[model samples]
Target: MSTQTQTETIVLQPTPHTEANTNENESTQDQSPPEVKWMYPKILSAGLSFFVAGVNDGSLGSILPYVIRSYDISTDMVAVLYGTTFFGWLVAALTNSTMTQYLDLGPILCLGAAIQILAHVLRVWLPPFGLFAVTFFLASLGQAYNDTHANTFVASLHGAHRYLGFIHAMYMAGCLVGPFVATGVASANVDSKWYLFYVFPLGVGIANLALVGASFRDRMASALTSSRRRERRERNASGGALKEIKETLSISGVWLLSWMVEYLVNVRDGDVKQMGYVPAGFYGGAFLGRLLLAEPTHRFGERRMIFIYAVLCLGLQLIFWLVPNIITEAVAVSLLGLFMGPFFATGISVGTKIFPPELQSSAIAFVFVFGQIGGSVFPALTGIIATRVGVQVLQPMLVGLIGASGLSWLILPKDAELHRD
Candidate 1:
């Protein structure tokens, strides 16, 4: 049954469940709690986790030149990193709900942090080529767990769009810093030891672990006890999760939004070049965009406002394509980033509002998985296309992606992106 929404903020409510499940699972922590004081700390921890993920993800572009030279790998071999990162997220996306069943949120976050830290540690020593590629797997898994749960957790709070922006902006902030630090470290040594860049994220990853543990101490209790009740809870959780997954996949907006983010980032050679300074501007633009979403979104409802922003993004992307000047290109790219920054988090916000609490964890996980599939497939696809068609193809390719992204935003439900499951 569809849960109708009269206002944009009404997304906090979930789809109606059967009477039996509603009463039994009513305490499922999907609503904003009456007690708001402690939530701030947990939210801060969640933001920090996204920061770590940004650093890890952002460092790769800066360090890739070094990897190619040092490892003597062909361009095709580099695709392995994307594959590993994709699969790592795929694994986390698949197993995250099950882990939630067996472990509390705090421990699960700690597990992700630990894995990311391990990946960075291995990188600092300049592991073998194959081993270095595998590190991305560890990093992506760590990111998916901490950030996805953090997103769902924050979406449950009051004024969710604001908090969602806070965490996602923290991610952009990390992306802004990652390449800056990586470039400096890699260029410093006479030997050009790009591996040293991992050290920065390693320290941050350790701090992320501490913050999650300290902030979420109340929910950190071990949940490994075996019993009939535990077994029943797992079974119920699994069943609800499957239902949510089915419903989430049925929504066109979910898939469209996922493709938007992937296309924007992956098609680097198209209208956008891998110019270091220009990309930094884009990340910085995204930082400001996410941080400042409240006023406009409130003034014009989210559904309508987001569509406007997307149309503006398409226009900016066109300017980037047609203008021959580097300065114009830089300005257009940055502005484009500003408009497109909210794509991923907005989709997650819709999922939280539409799916029931029992269905949410799994459904969100699957949505995340689809959001990521393009990241795995697009980099290699773009590279091969670039090799065959020349970099000029980026102009039209980007135009198509931006146009499609904007259209997809329009296709989302007018009422808080509601979907009847």
Candidate 2:
């Protein structure tokens, strides 16, 4: 039974833009689908999942200090909790390449949301340390599915690079809001501040489930062709999971980008926010970056803007490291955030331009997985060093990482093409 039906299919990532649909008559040269209605609402709905994830992840990180205090845990032990989520992301990336082959958005998203709710509830119970890590991993498992699938779905509907800003910005908006809400709840002297966080996932899950159920009717179908089917059947004998992973890792660019993100978070973040003002500044900058600067940045030039951003980030890091005053440091930190805010989303756009649609998911996931590795590995290393060299010196070391990101971007294969439109 050959499932093969010959038709040329082009898969678009972030968003789909086709030459057939391009209109020369339109004055504005926007590549987006013209005369489309209802699409915006659907995009927003899909982005809401990222929003939920942002809040959940951000709030947890914001109040982690409290969690540590309450549990009387050491920094090393607490770092494990952070590392656990990274491992979850890594596993999800590896698994998703195969998982996307068999699953549809509706069921997988619903299941992910349910798992998140369960993880939140389990966290409130204050289980043992190992149990806590397991629960976090469970939540991350859901997050990975939701995040990757949502991006893929949205990309299928529209030009992914153009609209990815809106999606990522919404996520950043949630990240900004989560801390505010969590802090407010935690301040009320209520034994249940953490409990309030669960309310979001619960309500969101119910709504998302309904939304997905209705929308699945028009969604794209994933059907394997006979050739692909044969490939899969033989995949087991052809080196199996090990082969799959090796093939994925063989993509040099993905590993390079991933390592870049890893360096940024693990190494640079310490310097950026050693005094706690960096997140506030960065998120604010991110809000403006996505909301205000994203289009112009993309329209005029994405690659040039990125280069400029990297240079500015390097300077900001120097200021944050050298300036002794809290006020001055805060100012520099905020400015740094403004420039650095657009890095990931812009990079995503660049990637969408580089990779074909069919390979987009794996490419996106590959970079993210590497970023997570950096996220997990560097932070733990910093913690170990912080004990001996003191946390203050970690700031200068962080500057080095930010510089590394810039250097990596310079070495990118097609830096010249990045500025094309």
Per-candidate TM equals 0.79, 0.74
TM-score (C-alpha, index-matched) for candidate 1: 0.79
Candidate 1 lDDT by residue in tens digits, 45-160: 98999899878766666666567668986545666787887788767755654565567667887888999999999999788998998998988888777776676667666566
Best-performing candidate as measured by lDDT: 1
Give the distance in Å from residue 60's predicted Cα in candidate 1 to where it truly belongs.
Answer: 2.1
lDDT of each: 0.64, 0.55
Cα RMSD of all models vs. native, in order, equals 7.3, 8.0
Number of clashes in model 2? 8
Residue 372 in candidate 1 has what lDDT? 59
* Candidate 1 deviant stretches above 4 angstroms: 1-32, 224-274, 390-395, 416-421
